[model samples]
Target chain A: MITFDDVVKVYPGGSTAVDHLSLELPTGKTTVFVGPSGCGKTTSLRMINRMINPTSGRILIDGQDVAGQDDALLRRKIGYVIQHAGLFPHRTVLDNVATVPMLLGKSRKEARTAALGLLERVGLSAEFASRYPAQLSGGQQQRVGVARALAADPPVMLMDEPFSAVDPVVREGLHREFLRLQKDLGKTIAMVTHDIDEAIKLGDVVVILRQGGKLAQIGTPQELLDHPADEFVAEFVGRDRGLRSLSFDTAAGLPVRPLTADLLLDEAGRPVSWGDGEPTGGTFTVEDSLRLVTDLAITSPVGIAVRVDANGKADGLVPHHDLVDHLAERRAAK
Target chain B: MNLSYLFDAAHWSLTADGSIPQLILSHVWYVVLALIIGTIIALPVGLYIGHTGRGSFLAINAGNAGRSLPTLGLLMLMVTLLGLGLTPVLIALTVLVIPPILTSAYAGMRTLDHRVVDAARGMGMRPWQVLFKVELPMALPVMMSGFRSAALQVVATATVAAAVGLNGLGRLLIDGLAVNDYSRVLAGAIVVAVLAVVLDLILALAQRWIVSPGLR
Candidate 1:
């Protein structure tokens, strides 16, 4: 866990980059710092690794004060990833990932072996190991950056807009991979990004800051979307937050009807068509989010969403009206 | 123009003091000595200024000042003060070598992607480690170009040593001119030009070997 205890950062010229801010980033989870420009999200992230020293108060990592630690030592324990990967242009992808391990006193062979595994863990093939950073695409480079940060197996990772450099399609793919990796590693992570949707997608906890580095709200993605603390937060999370919040709830609890004869099934029990027409909309599963189910139901020509089982066999259906009723019940409970 | 002097086996005798082989050795000795002294004096200062961003004014102005000071004039002044031998010639050649090296080193550091440096520091590299491991390697291409130019200048300029009673390839030119033997002067000119090209080619090969293939 990382704790910010009334931390403040006043630049030499008297600009308050971070006002008196206090927060706890829970261990083994991702906390995202998000804000408009000059809100100090990046500054706050840097403070955890002592990249930017706080003018007053203390930042503690796992109960130890970072201010008292040596800059290099503290940084070594905290992995850092930034936009553009900031890779060493001269080093091959494998050696770049092996940097921290070698710094930590691992032999070259040991570090390289560890790095090769890490590259695979980050979804890169072995062929990429010998290649220079310049040879890879922006998305590939970012993956290598993540691999390098994880090479030393540090408990804490700090990311500064790590995905912002890639295109949206690539960013989506990276986001999924990042979440999968985080699930397995369970490292304490603090990431800074200006994009709220990205924060909502990746963060287990979201911290929103106003223009003057003041805290606007701090909560889970659903909490911020469903119950914004103020008008500013409500506007910041956007008008479609209610619809967005449904992503947190799964379609499992919604009432489903028995698949009737009108809905044709394949030999494997997968939904094939509705009456004489093909299933116009895609199918969802019980594990899928309510938002996806809702979308499928609304888009289906027959006004029903087919819910598939684990084996991709159609077993249930949720009519559009039933989804509306379920949504109403959820809102009333909230 | 003077093929006879170069082709003459008698003039090529290694044992003879003023023969082509001996003159070439003396010329090479002067160039090597000047380069060693210049690099020792300039490389560290250049790296320091480039790394810290301090003394930038000194770095920027030193190049122009060093260039403007005529090598012949400086050598003559040094000879007047110190009264000759190899010292005055070395002093002038070393001065000629400093500016390019210092300026290019500074420019190399300044032009580096700041983000790479930030990443290095963030990864827990000590200041010295960052300099030697990251900054120095990246800056090599620029620094080598500077060193090559310095070498070329020194090789060409070391000929002036012959004007000060020193033994070098320049002896052929000065001695040839005195006796009106155009063949020896032409032989000296051809040898110096060839030596400069050969030295540059060697340095270029060294640069290719040392610099990372990734950069290319």
Candidate 2:
């Protein structure tokens, strides 16, 4: 757990990077700090590890004053990932990941073993252990960077726009990987990014900052989408955010389709023949949201419809009741 | 000019055909000894300059000054101080190796990536650990180049010992010059060049081993 009590940062040139920012980052959850450039999201995240010291007030990690501790020691207990990965070009991937562990007095063999395992956990093959950072692609390098951050298994992770340097496709890929890692590790993660959709997809809680490093808002994705604190946040999360609220809830139920031999063959399961009775017409063709379902119950149709695959077996069969209930639930969540 | 003369010279130095073989043996030994001693003196000084980033002005100026010092002037001065012997020649040769080495080592260290060093510090490394583990590995290739050039300079300069009547291949050249025998001068010069090239090749291989590819 980390708490910031009116922490402020004033640069030597009299620029205020963070202005009396106070927020609590719950432990075992992912909180993303996001805003435009110079908004101080990165600065705030760095303060948790004492990389950037606070000018006033206090930053407490698990209630201990982080400023009083040795900076190196404080950093060792807090995982940090930066853009470009900031990996030591001189060290191999394994040694790069093991840097903190080796410094903390772990034996070389022990550190290497831990690093190799973390690399594998982050989706890298053990063969990349001996290779250098230059050997990995952008996405692979990001994974190795993540692996290095988790090498010590710190209770909290601090990321400063780590995925922003990669291309959109790779950025999205890294976002999914980060989500999986966060789910599995359950570390108190504080990531700073500039992309709004990324904040929504990866953040368990999103923190939005305004131009002057002022706290604009902080809330769960659904809450922020449903109830933005101010116009700036609403605009930043974008007008489409309300539509995004649909995926927030846990999926209610799966539609039931007819049990047919051909569909079952494609599904690679046991086949059951369709009788005179329909499976309540809850199946819709894979292609009929805006076009022909060949048989689908949609906006204009009130009755249930059964859609079949090329093999004449049920693929997606939608019922009017299921469709109406699902839409209503989605709209209400929004 | 013939195999007999070579065999005769060899036997003379070791098995008593003449003192010529002994003269040649002593000369080779002198060159090798001076190189080892100079390397010991220079490597530490070079590494220190690279690490400390201080006194570089004096050190670099001193190296250029040493290189500019005429071997005859250096030898003549040393002869006055230490007397006409192997010690003066060795001192002069050692001073000759310093400039190339110190400059290159310092340049290499200064050029290493600050980001890598910052990352090292961020990972909890002490200042000394950062220099040795990070800076040194990055500096090795360039540092080795310095040593190679210095060693070559030493090999070429070692011949100056003959000007003071020391025994070396320089003695053969001196003897040949007195008798107007150009072949002996050519032969001695060829041998020195080949020796320098071979030593450079060895150091180049060592450079490969020292510079980890990833850092490059």
Per DockQ, the best of the predicted structures is: 1
Q: After superposition, how far is residue B27 of candidate 2 from its true place, in Å?
A: 7.1
- TM-score of each prediction: 0.97, 0.75
lDDT of 2 by residue, A23-46 (tens): 999999989999989899988987
lDDT of 1 by residue, A67-136 (tens): 9999998888889899999998888999999999999999999999999999999999999999999999
For model 1, what is the error of residue A81's alpha carbon versus the real structure, in angstroms, after optimal superposition?
1.3
lDDT of 1: 0.93
The digit string of per-residue lDDT tens for model 2 on B1-216 reads: 433433444435565522555555665576678767866776677667766777778657867887787877888899999998889988887778777777777777777776566556656567788878787887877777777888788777787888897877676578768887666666666666776787788878887777788866
What is the per-residue lDDT of model 1 for residues B98-214, given as tens digits with 9 covering 90 to 100?
999889888888888888888888888888888887898888899999999999998888899999999888898999999999999999999999999999999999999999876
Proportion of native contacts kept per candidate: 0.66, 0.58
C-alpha DockQ of every model: 0.77, 0.42
Output DockQ, candidate 2. 0.42
lDDT for each candidate structure: 0.93, 0.76
Off by over 4 Å in 1: none
Candidate 2 chain B: minimum summed lDDT over ten consecutive residues — where? B2-11
